[model samples]
Target: MNLSFFDQFASPSLMGIPLIIIAMMFPALLLIHQDNRWITNRLSTIQSWLLHMITKQLMIPLNKKGHKWSLILMSLMMLLLTINLLGLLPYTFTPTTQLSMNMALALPLWMATLLTGLRNQPSISLGHLLPEGTPTPLIPALILIETTSLLIRPLALGVRLTANLTAGHLLIQLISTATIALLPIMPTVSILTSLILLLLTMLEIAVAMIQAYVFVLLLSLYLQENI
Candidate 1:
């Protein structure tokens, strides 16, 4: 019974083919392509407006060179947001809940920014390891500490997304189970629990959106530093 709660996190497969890939691709399919028409439908208009707002907010802190990444960042944000919200649906799997998937997304982008810094301005990038006027005794220790912190950024990114979604899912499941179990013995308490569950579901929806935005926002901040 205890292990059943964790089973939800496992990647679903059929005939030895993982369906997580399909889940990841599903969001992109929902995006509508714009035509040459002068006017568009309400759905398309709303999509365009949201994308515009997100892109504008993300690009505010970035320099002109960083703006080149607007498309990639916006697409990533939408993908994550869709996956998170989709996971809340009944019987749907969330790819972002897996640490491996999150790390795969994080490491490449993090490495890209790091590599960009190294390629464009090697001196400035290396200078980030140490500050000016540091005592000789603390140099080695500070470099070690900074290097460790630098290496942990991608790991932190992956863990943060995975942990938040996983915890929310677990809490929802637990509360739902309690509500069901109490319905037979304590009708009043069960209804109250159900109401609480409803509120938690709404909060989870907000968390789903916020976490996606945060993941992208941090990447943009990292890019800002390197660029």
Candidate 2:
């Protein structure tokens, strides 16, 4: 029984083949594709509007150079948003909950931004390692600290998404289990727990959306600095 809770996170397999790839691709397959129509349906219109809003918000802090990333970042945000929300469904696995997957998504993008900075403006980029006004004695220490912080960015990005989704899933599972266990013996408490579970599910939905935005937003910010 103890192991069963964690089993939900394990990748499901068919025969001997793992289905994780399918799960990862499932969300993208749900998106509506345009068929050369100038006028779109209501669903497609809403999707387009939301995409426009998100793109506008993300690009506001960035310069023209950074605007080149609009398509990539928007697609990433949509992918993450869809996957995160899909994970909340019954019997579905969330790839974002895996540290490896999140890191894979984070590291490449983070490295790209860092590389862009280093290649385009090496002096300015390296200058960020040590503040201009620092005293001579503290220069070495401050550089080390800042360097460490810089290296930790991708790690933090991965762990943040993993931890938040994992905790919320675990909490939902625990509360759901308690509600089920109490249904027969304590009807009143069971109902109360169910109500709380409902509220938590709603909150988790919001978290799913916000975390996706935050992940992309931070990437845009990093790009902003580099550009």
Judging by lDDT against the true structure, name the best candidate.
Answer: 1
Candidate achieving the largest TM-score:
2
Candidate 2 per-residue lDDT over residues 1-227, each given as its tens digit: 87888887787889999887898898988998878988889999999899999999999999899999999999999999999999999889998898989999999999999999999989999999988889999998999999999999999999999999998999899999999999999999999999999999999999999999999999999898898
What TM-score does candidate 2 reach?
A: 0.98
Candidate 2 weakest lDDT stretch, 10 residues:
2-11
Off by over 4 Å in 2: none
Candidate lDDT (C-alpha), each: 0.95, 0.94
Residue-level lDDT tens digits of model 1 in 1-227: 77998889999999999999999999888889899999999999999999999999999999999999999999899999999999999999999999999999999999999999899988998889998999999999999999999999999999999999999999999999999999999999999999999999999999999999999999999898788
C-alpha lDDT of residue 17 in model 2: 100
4: Cα error in model 2, Å = 1.5
lDDT of 2 at 224: 88
Per-residue error for 147 in candidate 1, Å, reads: 0.7
For model 2, the local distance difference test gives: 0.94
